[model samples]
Target: MEPRPPSEWEDRVRELARQFSYPPAPDLRSRIPRPGVRRPRGRRWAWAAGAFGAFMLALGILLASPARAGLLEFLQIGAVRIRLQPPPTPSKPAATPSPASGAIPETRMLGILDLAGETTLEAAQAQVPFPIRLPTYPPDLGRPDHVYLQGMGGPAVILVWRDPMRPDRIRLALFEIGPGALIEKITPQVLTATTVHGRPALWVEGPYLLQTRSGRWELRRLVEGHVLLWTEGEVTFRLETDLGMEEAVRIAESLSAP
Candidate 1:
């Protein structure tokens, strides 16, 4: 009985000694403090990064909208047209002619509505503000009742028209006035429609300079049934001065194309 008891007791004592001798790794709690500062700092940086990213995304969406994009594009394209000429010079004066000739050879060209028996050379001169004759050539265009006025003057040309039948409808035509064969019908896009001395007209492409032939004096006329625009290389002239439409008609009524 005594030997058995020694064996059991020795085993129990050995187990207890081993457990206490290990001294549990220095209470892990002391090595690491509560709520370490490093973790919170890292979390703060991540939150700030996420907030900044969100703000940039919102701003990008607003600027890319369709209406704002179109406005930006519109600012890039522009449209403009203009014409310039030199100052007019003095030149030889033109002679005053009898209204009956109904033809002005000095005039580089002329146009009129042929009235056959109704309109006469004598009648047209009486209506014009200055001495002028009826056009000798046929109507410039088709077999239509309306007549077309066209002519060239040195570096410039003259264009005008009226209805022979109506005698009231008048048109102050335009063509390229230059050194070469006058380009009939100046590019309309190059001119601006306006009222010059009360008549409807298309001014040469410019801020206010009306004529196209450089350094030439231009003459503009508008009467009850007639309208005229003429120029001599350096000596321009205008006949009917005021009330363009009405004056244009009056002058047009006086025409009788030969």
Candidate 2:
């Protein structure tokens, strides 16, 4: 039998198929899992955790060492670093004559004349590169009784004031250490953090061993009074006095170049 003529519905379906467009089929061979191959998941997270653990282990080992622990327990301000130390041992008393037996007790005082590089204030100012400053808080405070200059890589100027009543005793001393000079203080007492003229400072009480080092010179002094340490510009100021913290800070804030 002869094929029947195409119907209208058949013609319409053919026309619709011709007008439609389709995308090419994607290749699935590469994406399919192989029999013996395993993919690594979360590998980045595992690496991160291992690295963190190693850092923590190294830090713990460093903190456990006794000799190394002292390296971290210091406070540095300007050119000075203060370290905590154990209290010094007390010495046994020696036999001596009584005060009522016409014997005078020896008094130890800071000897300004014994310091190196003793010179006039004008001479010190001429030798140093930085300006010399003096405090004006105590209106009656006059000029320094003595001035000393130390060559510690750079110039270190010291100004000393003597008590009028007790000429043998020192009333105040101001140390101006320039760059390259280093000071190390060892104290058994705790140090208090303070501020002078809004700048950071350190207040140390009681007696301490003060050591200063330069190129080839090193000096050690036993400081009996309190100390105020701070930095202004490139110079570090150390004020040694018997005054309280509030008064010391006030004096520090009143410093002016003269």
Candidate 3:
């Protein structure tokens, strides 16, 4: 019969037999030395030791030099000098004021009326003269025809009007209404009516007042004369001339109301 299938043990035996053949040993021909071979005497370590000693000696010499110590000290001194310097200073500015409060002052009364009336009249009379010369009236008459005295004194022009029933009325009219013309520029103030000599009379503001038993005299200035007139109701009496306002007031205070 054909070769039967080999048993497992037989196959393993065959494989082992195949592997048992010895392989040829590697050739150990010539024993040659590698190029640049060195002996292990630790020469590299010795050279390293010598170089380290030389570096240490150089470092020690450099440290011992005065210049090196001086250079280090100079660096330290420069650092201290930089630290010691002061910083820059700043400038100051001017002050200003606020804008809330206003300006200007205040006042009271302004006109002449606010002053005392009698006092002002006295002041006015002191400055001027009265009972001045009357220029010839009715300027049409020829020279020296006839001289008739209309007014009481030299300069006062007393007017006489014909009224049979009121013959004495013309004399009474003088104090009530002055002459036809205002001779002096009289700045009139307040006027009040008073009873003098037991009759109605007017108290007009002027130089000042002299109310006496004789009559009421007022300081007045005509064109050329400064005179005092005693006015009692409708009657006017011419008194002393050339009197001042202050003097008139003084003279007035001395008299009694009549």
Candidate 4:
């Protein structure tokens, strides 16, 4: 291979380079002292950066998901939306109970609907879709004497059975749950699961605490005995009576469409 001749600007370029010598790079490594002294700070900064990156990644994942937005946890069913977590601690004290009614005053967050009325069985059945079941064990008991509708969470059928021996005595409050309703099982109530009519059922005995517009009402009016809860198809049934567990089970098993 033959050596090529230099260009016309080669000498000029070399002269210019020599006139203005390239400056040496500053020793950044020397400026940064021994690694031992700064090791803790570097580690802390590294950890902070890593944590920030992880948080950003997690936030991105949460935002990407359309199902869960923001921090509030919830269970959505049809038109109803229930919080999976208890509400945030209230900043203000709860409203005072009323004097005349002796019930918790109704508020935006709290509500109540007393459906106990002197209505006929046929009239109540005409309103809902599900077949209302009446206990067949005590045939003489026949149809419910008083019917009530729990019109709050969902359309639920409340059947009252007056004492056979004493017609004035209200003995039972049975209810049938409507479709897509959310049943919130709160504290202070003994919740047990048993089978009735070969179907899984939840039995609640003793007093249970609940929040209502009537303030906080401990539901123990006539439910001193126990409650038998069972679901048939999309509908859920609950029999609130002062009867024993065995009797409740027997009654639940004998539930037949009227």
Candidate 5:
């Protein structure tokens, strides 16, 4: 019979194993037995076998857990992870009621102003651990109209620029997520693998729910624009705009410390 193909679980395990980084081996030469010292040859082999067994046990436990499995399904890029969930089921409409009954209340969509932790750009910069970067491509594009400091493992800085012609409309928004921070998106319309400055990146076209959890607080917003996600050193950037991919990439590449 032909060789059997690997199962999904097996494939996932192999992928994860490739990404796993093991601790550096300690310097054993200095600890080796001196001229007068005597040690059993089988002792070293037994110790090595024990350590390998323990590591395998831990890996098995994590892979077998449901919670961990869910986390493993996400496509992670730096501080962000995108998970595709099944589309929500549509609800059936109810029959219209008489005048005696009150009309159903309309659900209001959340906008940039509705987000919490609003603050001045200077204040946001001071609060975050990472340096905030600004795009220099659009020479006329000045400073951000609004700045926010929100939590995602740690404090994340958000900068929003509004259209000069239409002050009420946002032109662009940038999220600077530093080390330990994480952003998750659920069921985006499209996700394409891309690259920026030779580093891996993700392009997400959205009308999806984006969420970030920190301690007891959880923030959720509906994203309607395309997002370019990339990382530079320890900082992860998320640029949201209505512009096409080429323009977005140019803007991303023009980021500089301000």
Candidate 6:
């Protein structure tokens, strides 16, 4: 046995046996599912589906209601704010605007509200945040022949001066705005920019439509020169008169506690 130590032929036979005698690999092919056939089992997918459904439901509800247009057009100067909106559909073709793109419905410019109630000067002053002022330069103008309180935005004070020259004619109207003032869908025939006591003011002259309520916009005529709008303290003032600009400014400057 010592003489027969490993021949070259025996070594080659041993090497061949080692190459063909390895163990079989585990069955990995059956463990993993096919990529296209597998479905997601995570809660993430469920959450994503629910979120998408909720968004669609909210969008549908908004569209079902009366669609309101966003206020893309508006102007704010001093204490007054103006909003321009799409006009209501008229049965007949509407008249072409005088010069501006849109005008306030007439109803608001003259008298924004139908005021049936009257109050004394003391009572009216107590209800509003701002003091009611009367022009003192024109002594004849005296106390407001008519005092009306209306809620347009907040509380509004209306002071009417009857024409001394003409019988039963309105000479001037002064309005004090509480909280603020709003003019909707307004396109003025003439608009002037000026100042009073170094405070910025506006003069809106001519005819325009104004809207406060949804379907109640009406056109108002400005037979007088212009409407003077100015703000003092926390309140805004609107003055309508037949007087000239200087006279209007004088009246505004003459505002004193009545």
Total clashes for model 2: 0
TM-score of each: 0.19, 0.59, 0.16, 0.52, 0.60, 0.56
Worst 10 residues of 5 by lDDT: 97-106
Candidate 4 to native Cα RMSD, angstroms: 28.1
lDDT of 6 at 50: 62
Among all windows of ten consecutive residues in candidate 1, which has the lowest summed lDDT? 74-83
Per-residue accuracy of model 6 over 170-255 as CA lDDT, tens digit each: 78888777775454325445455556775556677644333223334345532355788787766788888888888898999899
lDDT of 5 by residue, 32-74 (tens): 8879887776487566446544444334333445455444445
Count of residue pairs whose backbone atoms collide, per candidate: 25, 0, 10, 2, 0, 13
lDDT of 3 by residue, 1-258 (tens): 898997554454344334323234536354233588663444664554464334323322223443433332111010010111122232443232111111111222111112121222233223223331221322331122111222112123222222246442221112111232122212223222222222222233322221112232222222122333334322243322233433433333333343
User: In candidate 1, how many Å is residue 183 off?
Assistant: 8.3
lDDT tens digits, residues 17-59, model 1? Answer: 3332222344656546457445566477566446433422322
Off by over 4 Å in 4: 1-89, 93-118, 206-221
Where in model 6 is the C-alpha error above 4 Å? 1-72, 83-115, 206-223
Candidate 2 all-Cα RMSD = 27.6
Error of 4 at 47 (Å): 46
Clashes counted in candidate 5 amount to 0
Model 4 Cα lDDT, one tens digit per residue, 1-258:
899886434543344334322236667686576656655775775664464344333333333443442453542222223233344555666554221112222222111143333356787678777777788876677877777654435566667777878765567767676885554432213544356664445556533223333444333334456667666666777777777778888887788864
Write down the lDDT of every candidate, Cα atoms only. 0.30, 0.63, 0.27, 0.53, 0.64, 0.58
Supply candidate 6's per-residue lDDT for 190. 49
lDDT: worst 10-residue window of model 2: 97-106
Winner by lDDT: 5
RMSD of each: 39.2, 27.6, 65.1, 28.1, 11.5, 30.4
lDDT of 2 by residue, 1-258 (tens): 999997554554455334324234648577566898665643654553464344233322322444543444445677766554432433654343221111113223336655667789999999888899998878878788888887655678888888889887888888898887766665425466566765567787543222222221222332357889888777999898888899999999989863
Model 5 / residue 105 / CA error / Å: 16
